[model samples]
Structures are given as structure tokens and as C-alpha cells.
Target chain A: MSARLRRLWGMIRKESLQILRDPSSISIAFIMPVILLLLFGYGVSLDAKNIPLGIVIEQPDTATQSLAGAFDRSEFFHPQRFGAIQEAQQALAERRIDGILWLRNDFSSRLLSGNEAPIGVFVNGVDSNQANITKGYIQGTWLAWLQHFAVAQGRALDLPVAMEQRIWFNPALSSRLFLVPGLIAIIMTMIGSLLTAMVVAREWERGTMEALMVTPLHMGEMLAGKLIPYFALGMGGMLLSVAMALYLFDVPLLSPFWLLMLCSALFMLVSLAIGLLISIVTRNQFLAGQVALVVSFLPSFLLSGFLFDIHSMPEWVQTITYLVPARYFVAILQTLFLAGPVWPVVLVNAGAMLLMLAILTVLVVKKSYKRLD
Target chain B: MSFFHILSLARKEFLALMRDKRSRIIIIVPPIIQLFIFGFAATYDLNDVPVAVYSEDRGGASRELLARIEGSPHFSILHQISSDAEIAPLIDDRKVLLVIRLGQRFSADLQRGDPAPLQLIIDGRNSNTAMTALNYLRDVVLDFNREWQHGHGQTGPPVKLEMRAWYNENLQSRWFIVPGIVGSLMLVVTLLVTALSVAREREQGTFDQLLVTPLRPVEILIGKAIPGIVIGLLEATLIIVLMVWFFEVPLRGSIPALYLGILLFLIATVGVGLMISSIAVTQQQAILGAFLFIVPAVILSGFTTPIANMPEMVQWLTYLNPLRYFLVIVRGVTLEGDGFALLFHQFWPMAIIAAVTLILAGWLFRHRMY
Candidate 1:
């Protein structure tokens, strides 16, 4: 074997053994992804269902009872009856219900007279997302009930326009289908940075870095050796995550497996290069961990369009998201998982990740060279 | 345990933390930066959802519908395609969230008083955003229907549903998310500081040195716990100030109630952190352990998503998360203007969590001392 190859092999073996010996690296690589995927898959959902809704009917009649029963029949609401509007309002305040539907005595009379009858919807809007969803659901329920009431009179309810909504990619509108795939990017980002930075920072803290520096190994070979093991470990985590997403979570993999794997490896390289750069700059392990968490982990979690929609952000924040590498990876993963290998989306995102990898690799090389000097 | 012993230990911790300029910066700086980033970035509100119009009918009906969609702030029309084939690229590339297709018979059907079929193709990849956009489109369509019905000399619809969102009338998601950043960020900072304390000392061989000191384990725990609580309170105070002043999230409730919740939350988090620290043999393990707790705590806390949406099994699991209770207290006090009575249920759970975890951490500290 060539001298350079031998030194590189030795470094890889050392890192591999350290990773095996350290329970933290193994857990971060394997167990962390499991925990994260399970939590994100089963625990977090954007679909608001079974909302506790308070219904107050001032008068007892078949019409009001039928309207209240509509709310009860819907999967989105769990309706509770209150005798008076004040009781329902109090229920809303006590957190016993998310919203209140008040029907005055005039409600049935107005409907019977064919006058404009308004139903009051009061939502606990402390959680605006839930509030908006609740408002939409209530309107839908009320409208459907109104249409049913109109049809019960043996005449057509004239609506000028009929909306035919064809929801592509995810017809069921399950948030898990998108969230589980996006989580792979986050897990890869965390494992890449945290694993490489902590391990390298430990070497520096233990003075093994100086010993390695005196060897005949080139800086590129040393960096490559440190990264190759972690690169493999991160890819392993990604594969495990993808499997869980498919089998355990039932999120479909629409695109070819190789494309997902190839793009994931590219993004993982970018993430590892970032970790290499961070560890080289902050030689202390604690400092390295902090910087990694702040720079890599938090940005990928918050700014990468993981949980939140990116286009909806303010123009400045949207501009900042372009700097986050996981943003591109998330786009690619979501496309691959949901929309198949629409080559335009996949290629553009993969190219962006490639550019990030190149830029981060250059920065890592420059910083390591500066350290050697 | 002597008061002076615990005081000296805490003083040593403060000096050790403040002595390193980087450590000082790490503690103080990242949370603030995160505050700004999360404040701006972590929102569920959809604004300017990109849409496309594919009108096969070159008539006034399509124009009227297009005009209505154009006037709305929620959607921005990025493409006006002339062909059916053009819709695929827009939706496939996610260049447009919705494609408004006006059928060739649209105006004719409307003129004949027949229902005009308006086909809307939506990218349902991000279901929440898609659902919200669909709701907005439904409103526009409903308005168009009402106007068209009135124009044709039909009576108004049977029932009008009037919605009034109580706490946040405008339904601004930032009002909901910013207050949440306070609890989650405080948890991150305090948990890391406390979780790393014992493990870091053990890694550097100072933990054994400390064990040989005159201070009891309880005194050591107090010394360790105080700095985390103090730092957490300071960090939380800074965030609450910025959340109210900088982010413009209204502080509608009593200050004392908010602080009372913050105190209990910090103690619970610090207790959890110290437990992890006592168990971890190294700083790396402490970090992994802290993260294992942090991710689930944040996700189950209903920070961005509602806990009521979660499955029943996960809902049961969320009761164990102290952040769950803290979120209710913080958002309730901040947005809902909730006082002590309304927030009573939120307080006692965190108090219990604090008591249980602190007791467990103390026992762990003593058991691990030898």
C-alpha cells in the first residue's frame, strides 16, 4: 500500500473504533433518528380533529337540534350542549371547549321564515392555527347543514359554481406523509454535525490531533478519513429513517430508491463538511457542540422549511432560508417521497446541495490549512 | 450543609462560566439570535401562496373569477397558461400551489343558470398549507356564488356563519409561536447548562475532586441547580421583553403569573437536566440524553402544532412533558390574558414535575457520588 493510503486507513480504523466504543456517537447516529422519526411520525400532526366545541341552543326545537347534531356527526368536532349562551361562553373560558356555537331562540324562527339566519361561532384563538382550522371546519359544517335543510324542502339549493377539487400528491392530506420525509433531512443534519464535531473536538481536547499532525498524513487525507466513517454512519441513519417512513409510518416512496440515496449522500457530505469546518474552528468540545447546535442543528430545524412553509415567510427570512443547505434537501426529499422523481425539482435541489458541499469543502480545507500553518 | 459552602460552589460555577468569554457568549448570544430567527421563521401562517390560472374559456365569467382571485392577498398568480399540458409543470415543480382551471363550457353553463364547474388542482404535499389555501379559495368561490346569485335575482343564502376568534381576532400565528419560543428556548439553554455540568466535571476529572470536598451531595446539587435557574430566568426575561417589545406580541396577562410559571418551568427543566447529567458518564452522553428529552418535549408541547391533534396514545405521553403545561401557562397568560385561576391547572403539573425530577436527581447525585 502507498504511504498516504496506509495513513488514511489507519485514521479511518481509529475513528471507526472510537465510534464503536463511544455510546453517544452510536446513539446519535442510530437511536436518535428512531426517536425523532417516531415522535415526528406518531406524535406531531397538523390535522386538527376531535376539537371540543360548545353548542348553546336557547330554544328546544327540531331545527336547532338537527343543526347541533351536524356538529356532533362531524369527525372534526366533539360537541357539548349548553342551555344558555353564557354557559357555553364560560365553557370556552374554562378551557373545556375550543369554540362555542350559539343559537338564539330566533334562529329556528328566522330559518322558518326564510330570512337571513346567522349562527355565531366563537373560537378560542390563543392557537391561531387551530383557530383558523376550527373556523374553516365550522363554516363547512354550517354550510352543509344549510344545504341539507334547503334540500329537505324539496327544492334545489341554487349554488352558481361547483368546485371540483383534485388534490394531487397527497389526496388524504395527511401531514405525516410530508413531515416524515422532511424529518430525514433534519436527522441527517443533526447526526452529521453533532457526530463529526464532537468526535473531532474530543481528539483535539485529548491532544491526539497534535500527534496526528506530526505524522506524514496530508491534511486532505486526514479530513477525508475523519469524514468517511461519519458519512457512512449518517447514510445508515438516513436509510433507517427512510425504511421507518415507508414501513412503520406508511409514507409512500414515490421516487426511485437510488435517486433518494444519491441525493441524501450528497446532502450528508455537505452537512459533514459543515461539521468539519465547525470542529476545526472551535477546538474545544463544549464550544464545538454549542456552535454545531446553534449553527447547523437549529437552522436546519427552524429555517429549512421542515415544519413551516418557506414561501409564506417574510421576504428577508425566505432569503435567509436559501443559505440553509437542509432547505434544498428537504425540498428534494419531499418531492422524491411525494411527487416522484420530477427531474427538474430533484436536479435543481441536488445541484444546490452540490454547490453547498463544494463551498463548505473549500472552507474546511482553508480552515484546516490555516490550522496547520 | 453550610450555607457558605453552597454559596462558594455556586460562585465558583459563575466564575468558571464568566471567565471564559466564549462560554459567556454561548450562554447569552445564541438564545437571542434563535429568538429572532424563530420569531421570523417559525410561523404556520400562509402568505402569498403561489397559484396559476388555466382558462380554457375566453369569456367574462373566467375573467370575473380571475379578477376576484387577483384581488385577494393570500394568493399570487405566477402563471397564466393557455394549454392543458402547461398545468403539470407548474404543479410538479411546485411553482404554483393551486391551478384554477375554468372549463370551456364555464361561461355557457353560467349563462344557462346551470352550475359552472371550476376545477381547482392543488399540490397537497404540504397538506396544512394546501388545506388553508383551499379554505381561502372556498371563501372566494362562496363570495362569487353569492354575487352571481344576487345578479341573477335570487334570494340570499339560508344561513351565514359568523366567526369571531376571541383571543387573537386577526389570527396572527406569530402571536401564538413567539411566546412558545420562550419556553422551548429556555428549556434548551437550562437543560444543556445543567445536563453538561456534572458530566463535564466528571470528564475533566474535577467531579471526583468535588466529591472529596466538605460539601454534601445536597449542597452540591443546590450549587449546581442555582446557576441553571438563575441563567434560565435571565434568558427568559430577555426573551419575554423582546417577545413583547421587539416582536410586538402583546403581554395581556399579569406579570407575576407569567414569572410564577417561568420559575416553576425552570426548576422542572433544571431537575430533568441534572438527572441526565448524573446518569451520563461524559459530556457527549449528556448532550445526547438532553436532546432525547428536548425533541420529544418540544414536539409534544404543542409549540407549533396542537396537542389535541395528536393521537390518544401520544396525548397521554404529552402529560409527562413539562413544556406542555408551561406552553399553556405562557400562551394563556400572554395571548388569552389568563389570570391565576385559569392557569391553576397548568401550574400544579409543572410544580409536581419539578418536585419529582428534583428528588430523583438528588438521589441519583448521591448514588453516583462514590
Candidate 2:
């Protein structure tokens, strides 16, 4: 082996052993991703299905019964019959049902007489997202009932204006297509920064830093030793999550796999550098871990445009999001996964990640460059 | 058996946390910063959606549609294009989310009492915003259609639905988030501190000292467990104060019930931490173990997302997660003002988790002592 290659090999051997010895490192690197992916894929969803709904028909005539019956038949809602409006109100407060549809006695008469009949829809809007979706579902079922009623009456339903909505990219509007891409960015951040944040601090805590100081190891060599193992581990994690995204969740990978792997490797390097810098600065495992979470995982989840939109935020907050590296990665992942890496988006986000890689490299080298006597 | 023995041991754990400068800051600074950051950061409001309009008809129907869209507060009409060609690039640049395209025969058809078609081309990258913006446009079109019908001396639509959101009429997201933040942040803080407790003593060579002390094994477990609960309680109290005072989210349910739920939650968390600490040889392992629990716990808890939407098996599995129950209790009290009677189903599950986990932790403590 070449002299530098020999040194690198030795470092890798040592890190591999350390990782094997510490089962938690392996757990964080491997087990954590499986758990997170399963949680995200199977557990968290914005899709509204079988939402419990309560319905009260003041007078149970054919029109009212049919209208209420339509709600019970929908794939979107599981509706229960309520005897009175007050009973439905109590159920809503207890969170037993998500919404209520109240049909008036004159529902059929008014429609036949060509007079306006108002139906009441009460939604439990405490969870604003669920409430909003429930509202849409209720309106949709009502619209379906109207069309069905018109067809049964053998009268042409006259609506002067029609809006044709064409949703580009994801026509079905599946939340998973967008959400899974963001999940990859989040999982990468967690393993990259969080796992490595304690490495150098752990060396300090174990009294190994003093022993290492006496060796003739260059700063670059030492950083490579720490980073290479975690980089490879993080990449392994990325691959696992990406596979799950493709096969398990069945989200289409429109972008080339090689290009995504390249971006993910770059993003992982930035995250690993952040972890090293934090560990070097804090030198206390407990403190370093918390700081890493503050700087890395939380920001990746919040400021990175994962769950919330960057455009919806205020101007100052938008400025802050630029500082979070995951923002660029999330943009890349979403574009690549959904829109197939339209070059302009690819160049901009990939270039920003490259900038971060340079900055974090300098930061890591500066901290590790300090002399230890 | 001695009360004073437990007190001294508890004091030592408390002082150990306070005396460490880093621990002191970890306990104090991050929670406050997270509160401010997460409060502002976690928003679901689809505010300030930028849209582009392509109106071909220079007639009254198109003009009226434009006026109605311009009036709504949710949209900022950033661009007006006379041609269809200007749209794709603007959407590609993400400069506009929705493009309102009116057909050439739009006003003519409306005048002739024939159907007019309006095309809304949406950028569905962020599906939630697209859906909300679509709903807003629908309301405008419905209103326009109704007015036109009335003006023509035609009868109004036979049936219409009136929507009202109960409890939270406006559905302000902060009402839910503030309470959720209280549960999630407290879990992390308490779990981290307790998970590191046993591992720290072993790392510092104080575990041997602790083991040789006059206190019994059960008392030692109590000493180790109490600090996490106390710290968790302190953090929970600070967050509740913020929810009530800073955010002005009303405290509707009995305040006692909320604390009772928190105490049970802390017991379950501390039990988890201690169990991990008992087996971990290093502090890093302990923290990672805590993380293993925290990540899945928070996700499964329905803190931000609803659990009912989850797969049937996953929903059943959430019964084991103490945070799931606590969140229900917390949201109940804060949003619905539900009392203990209505909240029993939430509490029993949590109490069971606490009892089972604490017992298991105590067993592990005994096994380790030997």
C-alpha cells in the first residue's frame, strides 16, 4: 500500500472496530433509519380516509335519509347517526368524530320547489389540517349527492360556469410523493450530524485525546479517519432509505439514481463536518449531542422546507432558511423525485450544497487545526 | 428505609446537574430557544400564495372574475399575462402556484346563457397549498355563478351547505402547536438527561461509589429517576406558562388534570431512560438509545399528524407509546377543555405504560446491582 493509503486503511480499520464495539453507533446508523422510514411511510400521512363523521337528519325523509346515507357510503368518511344536534356537539368536543353534517326537514321540498335549502356542516377544527381536509371531503360528498340527485330526477343540471383543474406533476395529489423526498433529507441529517457529534467529545471524555496528541497524525488525516467511516455509514443509510422510498412506498424516482446519490453524498459530507465541528467545540458528549440536534436535526425538520413552506414564511424567516443546508437538499430531492431534475433547480440547489460543503470543510479544518499540547 | 438517605441522593443528582455549566445551559437555553424557533417555525397556514392570471376575454365576465380574485386576502396577484406562453416559465421558476386561464369564449358563452369553462393550472409540488388555493378559487366561482343566476331572474340553487368550524372557529394552528410543543420538547429534555445519568456515573468512576453507598438499590433507583421527572416537570411548567401567558392560549380544562397527565408521562419516559442507562456501557450509547425512543415516539404520538390516518396495525402499536396518550390528554384539555371523566381512556393507557416501564426499570436496576 502507498504510505498515505496505509494510514487511511489503518484509520478505517480502527473506526470499523469502534463502530462494531459500540452497538448504539450501529443502531443509530442502521436501525434508526428503518424505524424512521417505517414511521413516516406507514404512520404519518395527510391523506384523509375513513374519517369518523357524525350526521343528524332533523326529519328523516327520503331526501334527508338519502343525503345522510351518501356520507356513510363514502370511502373518505365513516359516518355515525346522531339523534340530536346537541349529541353531535358533545361527540365533537370529545374528539369522537371529526365532523357533522345536519340536513334540514325541507331538504327535498325546497329543492323541488326551486327554493334555497341550507345544510349545516360543523367541523372540529382543532387540528387545522384534518379540519381543512374534512371540510373538502364533506363538500365533495355533497357535490356527488347533488349530481346523483339530478341524474335520478332526469333533469339536466344547469351550471353556467365550470372550473377544470389540471394538477401538474402529481395528478392524484399524493402527499407521499413530496413527503418521502423530504424524509430522505431528514434521515440523512439525523445520522450524519447526530451520530458524529459525540465522537470527538467521546474521545475527550475517555481520555484518548491526550494519547492521540502525541502521535504524528496530520489534522487532515485525523478528520478523514473520523469522517470517512461515518460518511460511508451515512451513505449506506441513504441507500436504505432511498430503496424504501422506491420499492416500499412506491414513489417514482424520476431523476437518475446516480445524480441523487451524488447530491446525497455531498449533503452527507456537510452534515458530518457539522458534527465534527460541534464535537470539537463542545468536547462534552451530552452538550455536543444537544447542540447538534439544535443546529442540525431540528433545523432540517423545520427551516428546511420539509413540513412548512419557505415562501409562506415572513421575509426574515426566509432569510434564515437559506442558512439551513437541508433546504437546498430538500429542494433537490423534491424536484428530482417529482419533477425529474429540471436543470435550473438542480444547478441552483446542487451549487448551494457545494458552497456549504466548502464552508463546512473550512470550518472543520479550522477547529481541528488547533494545536494540542 | 430512611427518608433522609433518599433526600441526600436526590440532592446529589440535582446538584450534579446544576453544577455542570454545560448541563445548566442545556437544561435552560435550548428549551427557550426551541420554544421561540419551533413556535414560529411550525406553521400550517397557506398564507401569501403567489398566483398568475391569464385572462383572454376583455369582457365583463372575465373582469368580474378578476375583481373577485383580487379581493380575496389569501392570494397576491403578482403577475398578469395577456398570452398563454408566459405561464410555463413562471410556473417552472416557482414564481406562481396557480394560473387562472380563461377560455376565449368565456364571456361570450356566459352572455349566451351557455357554460363557460375556467382552467386552473396548479403547481402541485406542495399539495396542501395547492388544495387550499383551489378551494378559495372555487368559492369565488360559486359566488359569481350564483349572482349571475339571480340577476337572470332564475331561482337560487335548491340546496347549499353552510360550513362552521367548532371549538377553534378560525382554526388557528398555534392553539394545537403550543400544547404539542409542550409534550415533544419535554420528552427530549427528560429522556436525554435521564439516559445519560447512569452512564455518566460509570464514565466518571462514580458508579462504584454510588453502589457502595448506604442507600438500598430501590432508593438508588428512586434517586436516579426523580431528577428526570423534576427536570421534566420544570420544563413542562415553563412551557405551560408560555402557552397561557405569551401565546394567550386559554387553559380550559382543570389545571390539575394537565399536571397529572404530565407526571405520568414523565414516569414513563424516565423509566425508559433508566432502562437504557442500565445497559449502556458508554454515555454515547445511552444518548443514542434515548434518541431511538424519542424519534419514533414523537412520530407515533400524533404530535403534528393524526394517528387515525395511520395503518390499522401502526395505530394499534401506538397504544404502547406514552406520548400518544399524553398528547390526547394535552390537546383535550387545551383545545376541548375536556375533564378527567372524558379523558379516562387517555389516562389509563399512559398509567399502564408508566407502571409497566417503571417496574421493568426497577428490575433492571436490581439485576445490575448484583
Give i-RMS (Å) per prediction: 1.3, 1.6
Which 10 consecutive residues of model 1 chain B have the lowest summed lDDT? Answer: B361-370
- Candidate 2 differs from the real structure by a C-alpha RMSD in angstroms, to one decimal, of 2.0
TM-score of chain B of each: 0.96, 0.94
Give the CA lDDT, 0 to 100, for residue B245 in model 2.
89
- Give native contacts recovered, as a fraction, per prediction: 0.84, 0.70
Summed backbone clashes in each candidate are 0, 0
Q: How well is each residue in A172-238 modelled by candidate 2, as lDDT tens digits?
A: 8878788888988988898899878998988887888877776666668777988888888888889
Give TM-score values for chain A, per-prediction: 0.97, 0.95
lDDT tens readout by residue for model 2, B26-109 = 887888877777777777776768888898788987888888888887777889898878887777667788998998899999
In lDDT terms, how accurate is model 1? 0.88
Segments in model 2 whose C-alpha atoms lie over 4 Å from true places: A1-5, A370-373, B82-85
Evaluate residue B297 in candidate 2 and report its C-alpha lDDT on the 0 to 100 scale.
Answer: 88
Model 1 per-residue lDDT tens digits across residues A189-222:
8888888877667778888888887878888988
| DockQ for all candidate structures vs. native | 0.78, 0.69
